[model samples]
Structure formats: C-alpha cells, structure tokens
Target: MDAPTGEQLSIRNRDAHAVVTTIGATLRAYEVDGVAYLETFGADEAAPMGSGAVLVPWPNRVAGAVWTHAGERHRLEVTEPARGNASHGLVRREPWTVTAHDADSVSLAVVVEGREGWPFSFRATITYALGDRGLTVTHGLHNLGDHPMPFGVGTHPYPRPGHADPDDCVLRLAATTHLPLDPESMVPTGGPVPITGHDFAAGTPLRDVDLDDAFGGCVPGPDGLVRHSLRGPRGGVELWADPVFGWVQVFTPHAFPGRAGRAVAIEPMTCPPDALNSGIDLLELAPACTWTAAWGLTPLA
Candidate 1:
C-alpha cells in the first residue's frame, strides 16, 4: 500500500536529516545527530492533531466560518463543527507536487483553485532545507487571481526536548501579550492584553502548565528574529521566525502518538486566529505579486 501521507521525500546535510511529505507539504520528520527534534509518527499513519501541517490563507479559527470581503459574505466550510468555527485553512489535506529536490533540500508546490468559500486563486510553495544550522522552512505564495488577495500563513511544528521527558522541559517565548479566546467557540473574545501567569517569556517548565493559547506582541531580539524554545537537561531546540510572524500559538496535549508524556506545539503565525474577518496583520498581495517568509528550528547544545 502507498504511504498514507503520499510521497515521503528525504533530505539531509551531514548530521541533519528531514522528511517532507507531498500531502500538505508536511514536515514529517526532522533530526540532527540521531536526536529527534520533532515528535514523529509512523510513515503509515496519517498526521494526528495537525502535526507538521502547513496553514495558509489563514491560521487557527474563523468565527462562524463566515467572513465578508469587499461587501460579499464568504461562508467557508465549517471544518471545526464542534466549535462552530473554521479551523486551519484550505490546503492541509490537498496534494502538492514536488518542484525541486536535492541531498539537503526539497520544494513542494500546490495551486489552490478558487472554491466556494475562498473565491481566490493562488500558488503556495514550501521548501525545507537542512544544514549545519538545522532545518529552515520557507513559504512562498503568489496571487494568481486578478484582484488583490488577503491571507496569513502559519505552521504546526511540535519541537521536542531531545530524549528527555517532555514534562521536564522548559518552554520560553518572546511574546508579551495574550489573545483571549472564548472557551466554547475557541475564537478570540477580545484584543490582546498584557500577559500574566501564562507568560512563557522567561521560560517555564512544561509540567506546570496546560495551555492552548495564542500570544501576540512578539518582540524580536537584536538579530530581528522572534525565538521560542523547549529546553531539557540533555539539550534543547529553538524555533525562530521572521518578524512577519507576529503571533504564536502554543498547545500542550498530554496524549500524542508514539509518546507517553505531553507534547508541545510552537506554531509561528503571520496573524492571529480569525484574522480573515478581523483583518489583523493580514497580508494583501496584488495581482502577479508574490510574498515569502521563513522560519526554522535549530538544535541547541
């Protein structure tokens, strides 16, 4: 039988290795020096809980699965019916074609055709490259339609704490504000607020926290990059993103495939949840224009 995630493409650079799948252009696996930096699943199993999936056009949820653009109301399919919201975006399960590949990198592209809800056309490309600095992922999008298009980009990458127990790891982020969400709808209830106890700005142990929160006001370091990390006694992993990714979503679940303890997903998003309607930090691309952004993971010694 074929792999559930379609073609599994492998790339490596010396001690660093990664696997990118054609479906969703997912980052199926990444490791350096035989130490897994990501929580990986079997090639035969489908991605669970949005593992390594790319979020395009929008990330997180769209309230009521409806949004108005230029006076026309667009109703997207309610993917998260339980919450009465549209979860993620339009391209995660779609198939992508391999555009380029080499020993240390691979690129995949998917053309999102105009659909009922999203009446827009665009080509999204994702490239994964491994080097001495670990894995770097680049997302490129080109508006194929005549009119301007607004969108956001994000990714779900669950970075682990090497071989250490996840609960023993410390999590840190560069965000100073938090976006409150409704418990039932899981949509933002208000604007950002000064973060308090949930703040991970100074690094907090995973065992003491249970979070499914979104944070904004990300402050870039002197290098102009927003960084987050999970550190353990052995080693750690750092996730760094461009300043364009203004929001970060952190989720910690106790159960994950192939793991006994909690797992944390540090998602770097260009905008917050429901940006499709709120228009917060959404990027508008003119016809024939292309936009690109990047984020990466580096194993820390």
Candidate 2:
C-alpha cells in the first residue's frame, strides 16, 4: 500500500490529544490517555471510508451527478459510480496547507479552484483544537469568486466508546425527523418523515439495528448546540455542533476495515443529501462573504 501524504499534526491539552493529517485535513486519531474515542486506522493507510473527513460545498450524494446554478447546469464527476451519483464533495481527499499552529490547535487551509463541474473558486480552513471539552473542530469558508455560490459543509467522525463494541452501545439524538432514502440511489426520496425505532428522540441501543439514514429537525440544547451521544458499559462520548448544522447523518456499517461489527459515523451536516438539487437548507454565499461552523466531541465519564 502507498504511504499516506502530507504532514501529521498533533495537538494536546490537559484533557486529550488528537492526530490530524494534512491530507484531506482529516482527524486520524483522537484519544484520552491510550483509549481512542474516534475510530482510527493504520497511519500508513488512507482514511478508511471517509472516516474523519471534512466534506465541503456539499456533504452527501448529488443525484445524477448534476446541478444547476444561475441558469447554468454543471455536471460533477461521479465519485459514487455504483449509485450513479456524486458522493461527498471535492475536498475530502485533497491536500491542505498549514496556515498556523500552536501547542493545542493547528489550522490548515485548502482552495477549490474553478473546474468543469464546479466553476467557482473558494478557500476553506479547518482548525482542530484540544480543550477541557475534549476536541473542538472549526471550519471556515470564504467565497473567492465574484458571484454568489451555493454551499454546504459537514464532517465524518466515527465515535467509538473507548474500545467498546458498537453493538452494545446506546445511541441518542436530539432529532425529531429522519430522511428516508431510495434503496437504489441512496438519495432522499421525498421530505422528512417521522422518526421511529428505539425512540431516537430519547435513547436507543445498537442491538440488531442497522441505520444509514439522515435526520433533520435537530433540537439544540440551551447551550445552543445540538448533541448526540454513544454510551457503553463503562462510559460514553458526545458529539456536539453549532445550530448552523441542522442535519445529522447517522451511518452504521456492518464491518469496517481493521475493525468488525457495527461502526457508527455521526455526521454533522449543514444540509441534507442532494441539497444541491433540492435547494433545501442550501447556503448562498455572496461575493467575499465567509461562513463558519463548529463541532466537537466530549467525553462522558
């Protein structure tokens, strides 16, 4: 296998330590003491299944790999070939440059230039910081082009309860509605539907439950952040995001490389899948405008 690319940045505070890779600006590993809170792969291996990847401009799949803006239809490269659609965005696998670094945080930036499918240019920065709250990740984007642009942002971080089996974990979300997807394309079929199973609004166990669904209508707490948690026998971990991130994509894969059984990926999204086509919760950035979103993980002992 080929070696991983770019620099590996480590940031630590009194509470936790995190490993961030310049390639895709991904979070390779995050742990408290020696136990890992985020799912991790070998250092030499590529980001497994978009684990800890930052999805930008758009988060999920785009149907037919096409979208229209300003009366112009753009055809994106189909990254999800099996589903006949474009998966994620362009930045997930790209390299980023270090802008600044400190003892507890590192900031990296990347630019998306004009291309056949995406004709707009923009710059984005991701900062990973360690604090008492565990780890806080901030993402910022600026429109470099002279016109308005539609955009969205998200991050893929698989949370593992300190080596606990995912099958025994209890998952909970503050979301009230869930998006149902078409079996073939794996795209949203219609609108948000009522949530069911394990009472996600309350708490649910991972026992025999299989999910690859996007949920919306997240009810943020008094602290102005939406939260999701995975609790195991010993302890738990919580994922929180700013109110700007109104959607969360929950995916539980049957087996992930290097790790078996269920692995959970709780993605905080500014928009749902195919938002480029549906125009649902899509953000429009004016010329020279910048937008930012924040999300983090906290350990619950």
Candidate 3:
C-alpha cells in the first residue's frame, strides 16, 4: 500500500546529517542537534518554509500576466492580488505523485493542467538526495504534451544554524545586481541596478541589514555552484544553485511561523519577479524539453 499521506515522508541520513522529503516536494528535517532546518520548503502554513516550491508556466511574479502559447493568448490566475498575476504556478499546493523512493532520496512528479492562463502542459519532477554533508535537490521538467512549454524552475529552503541565534548570524549573498521595485505595490519597476548597502558581495552581517529583493550576477564556485550562506555563532548553512537560477531571492522573515527570527530563506530562480509580463529571460522549451537545477546545504565547521 502507498505510505499514509504524511507518513510517506522519505528519511535520508548520512553520518550526522539527515533529510526528510514529503511526497510533494516538502523537505523538512530535524538535525541531530535539534535544529529543524527545511531542505525543501513547502508542507504546512505555520511551519511552511517555501510558500511556492517549483515555478512553472514561468517564474517569479507576473502582472495581469499575458503570454502567447501555441498562437493563443493565455492569462494566468492571479496568485498575488496586489500584482494581479499568478505568483508561482499550480504545483505548490497540488498533490504530487511519488515516482521514486528510498532511504536517502525521493522523487515526486506533478502534472500542471494548462488552462486559459497557462495553456501548455508539462510534467515536473523533484528529487531530494542526501550526501555525507548536506542535501542535493534536482528539478527535472519534461514536456508531456505536444505544445511547447514556456516555464522556469526554482527552489526555496529555509536554513537555520541549529540552536543558534539568527540575529547573531552573518549572511553572504553572491549577488551583484538588484531589481528596483515600485513603491506602491513592490513590483519590479525598472531593470537591474548596481547593488549598494543592498549588495552582499562581501558578505553582509544579517543584523546590519534588512531586505526582500531579487539579486543576480553572482560569482560561482569551481563546481559551477552559486552559493549563499547564513552563519550562526556555531555552525552555518549554505544554499547552492546554478546558472539556471539566474536570480536569488533572500528573505529574512522575523515573523516566521515556527522559530521566529531564526529563519532565512535563500531562494533559487530562473527569472525575477514578473517574468511573463517583462518577457525577460523567459524560456520557451521545445516539446519534450527538460532542464535541471541543484541546491543543497551543509554545516560549516
């Protein structure tokens, strides 16, 4: 029998590290040291880390969001009221079918129904793997229908320095450009601007700054991984990404549900807010096209 709804959580562990993945791309884990750091961010509201896990039909914020697919105009349902466009796609809250499962990993697939707003159909897979140090998440997309699919993929994880105070942590972001926002609705107003105090190129102490924005043009490691980190007094956590994640959104929610200010979200995305309306970096995948992106976390000694 299929594992019970919530009981289907995959448990992966290696030495002192462990990871948990719900059948629906919800990755939550209680580290050995008692830190409940979420490797994948969508499960519960109060305990939710990533509000929307995978971005599809497009990424980031879209306004009234009009798109042309297969010679027809498509308009997505507005997930963001203020912006009047679909925020993330339908995969976040939908039930995903379990494809692969094991001790250290699990794969889940979600079928995105194409409607007037999103007229192209696609199948998305999310894989969670645990290594000796941290977790590696892979997103795979395959066009299930004949029509071309225009979309993007992203990952959201809330990392915490187990049992450490967040205010005392230092945050290092690998971003060189930031999107300026509209004052009234907080939507993207113009193009990318040089980062100033808003910049975290040199690693900014978390306490010294406060922000919620999209950033890009970061330096990648030899492994071709773009990393952002939050360091607590004892240990730190890293959020790794790839060139596919052209933009990273750093969110420090002091009013977070579970642990208050001890949480920070390093989000990986292919585009910035409102990609559909802006028509910037939008990917129109040929039929049966597939793409992948990886991000993980490891404790720093």
Candidate 4:
C-alpha cells in the first residue's frame, strides 16, 4: 500500500465527511454521500495544483518575489520560478499543530516567525467542520510582535460537482469588476476593469475558457455574504464567504491531478493578488490584535 498522508485526521457527521492533513493543515478530501466535492489526490503525495492549501500572511503572487514595507524593500524566496514571484503564503507546506478534533470538526494551528525579509511573528489557526451545509472553514490570525503586520489570506480549493466533466459545468460568480493583469508578470495593472466574456455575474458555461483572474467589487447579498457556484448535470457546489473576503480568484487550469480534462479553482481572498506591493485591501493587524474570517462550501442537489 502507498504510505499514509502525514498525520491525517478524519471528521464526519451525518451530512458530510472530510480528511485533513497536518502538513499545511491541508484539506485532503471532502465528500458527501460518497460523492467528492473537492478534487483529491493520494494522501502520500503533496497537495496537487495547490489544492486545499491555505494562503496566509499573503496570497497569490508577490511580483519579483519582492515588496516594500515601511520604506524598506524585502525580498522573499522565489516559490514560483516561472514568474519569479512568491506564490501563495508561508504555511502551505509546513506542518501544523492539531489543536482540536471531533466527529465533525478539526482545528489546526501554525506559528510564523518573523525572518529577515518578512519581519513579524504571528499565530494562525484554521478550522474545518462538516455539516448539513457541507464544509465550513474559518481562518484566524493574531499578531504577536510589537510592530504592525501587513497581511492577507486566501484559500485554494478546486471544487467540482461529481460525475460532471468540468468543461461542461456552469460557473456563477457575484463579482462585477475584474483585476486586469499584465500579460507577462501576471500582476495587477491598476484598478478593477469591466469584465467581458469571462464574466460570470449571471452564469457562464465552463466550455473552453482559460481563466486565471482575480475579481473584486462583489455584490454581497442580504446576509453580507458573497456566493460563487459551479453547477453540472449531477449536482452543484457553492462557495460562500463573509464580506471581509472581498476578492475571489477564478482559475481554470488545463489539467488537474486525478481528473480527466480540466478543473476549476474558486479561491476566496481578503485582498487582491500582489496586495503586499499595491497595499490594496491588505489587512494590517496591530500588535496583539486578532483578525478572523469565515468561508464555507455547500453541496447543491
């Protein structure tokens, strides 16, 4: 047999089941009634295509893997060699501490110590729970250092409706504005721009469209939540987040592990990509202050 994923934890209720790994506190699997909602890989392998990885301290890319803070330029290790940018955040590959677990819920924590380039220590926690609504995830962060910390958070989950080929799925997003990107650097050019054929404000079929874009100007509903959805023939999946999550990234990669053709990644973000450099919607947590945000997924029949 293949080796087990490092320290996997299983949680389930009558409504759903989920597998979480301590490594990166990644969501290894999530299914309802034996139907997979999130594309999953073997436990022995690392997260594929950034599946279920939590991006903290920052999300998406940091252009040139460098940013300026408080008048000092800091360089980060290049995690994305192709673009020479620092992709994702700090803890995706790091082992996290399991603080709590039960039949329907599990919580993991990690500490990020301030290094030379990224200066400032902080503690972060991610909690996952299964319920009738599917899976809910909460991210929390507390600044431990004396100086203020500029940070952002995001989650990468390639959600799919069972049995329906991703190419045929219909995606609907509540966002109105798109963050235009520079073709080469993939960094935002300026403010939000009008969305064209790529728009999902109504509902758009996932037919042949290649997308790796960030969106803002979300039109939240009555409960102060933004909703994005993917619907196929068998069923559908919906991702909703608190208003603090003003940005959502829609990525459709050509091929995904453990899948046939393509996959859709609907990511929720507290800020736009390269926010560290632009200072756009980035959260600044003061010393000893705490920041919290909630997001979840629900299976649609």
> Can you write out model 2's per-residue Cα lDDT over 134-210, one digit (the tens) per residue?
89999999999998989999999998888567788899998888888998999989988888765986789988888
Across 1-301, the per-residue lDDT of candidate 1 in tens digits comes to: 9788999999989988899899899999999889999989989989999999999889999999999999999999889988888889988998999999999999999999867699999999999999766899999999999999999999999998788777888999999899999978989998889999865887888887899999998999999999999988988899999999989999999999988888899999999999998898888999999999999999988
TM-score of 3: 0.87
Model 4 gets an lDDT of: 0.89
Give TM-scores for every candidate, taking all chains together and pairing residue i with residue i: 0.98, 0.97, 0.87, 0.96
lDDT digits (tens) for residues 1-301 of candidate 4: 5333468899999958899998888888889889988889987887888999999989899999999999999999889998899999898988899999988999999999966479889999999998767799999999999999999999999887776777878999988889999878888889888788765877899897888999987778887898999998878899999988889999999888878889899999999999999998999999999988899988888
Which whole-number lDDT from 0 to 100 does residue 272 have in model 2? 92
Tens digits of per-residue lDDT for model 3, 181-238: 7745556888888887644766677884666778877768788878888777777777
Order candidates by TM-score, high to low: 1, 2, 4, 3
Report the candidate with higher TM-score, 1 versus 4.
1
Q: Rate the local accuracy (lDDT) of all candidates.
A: 0.92, 0.89, 0.67, 0.89
Task: In candidate 1, list every pair of residues with a backbone clash.
Answer: none
| lDDT of prediction 3 | 0.67
Clashing pairs in 4: none
Query: Over 4 Å off in model 3, which ranges?
Result: 1-8, 15-24, 30-33, 39-52, 68-72
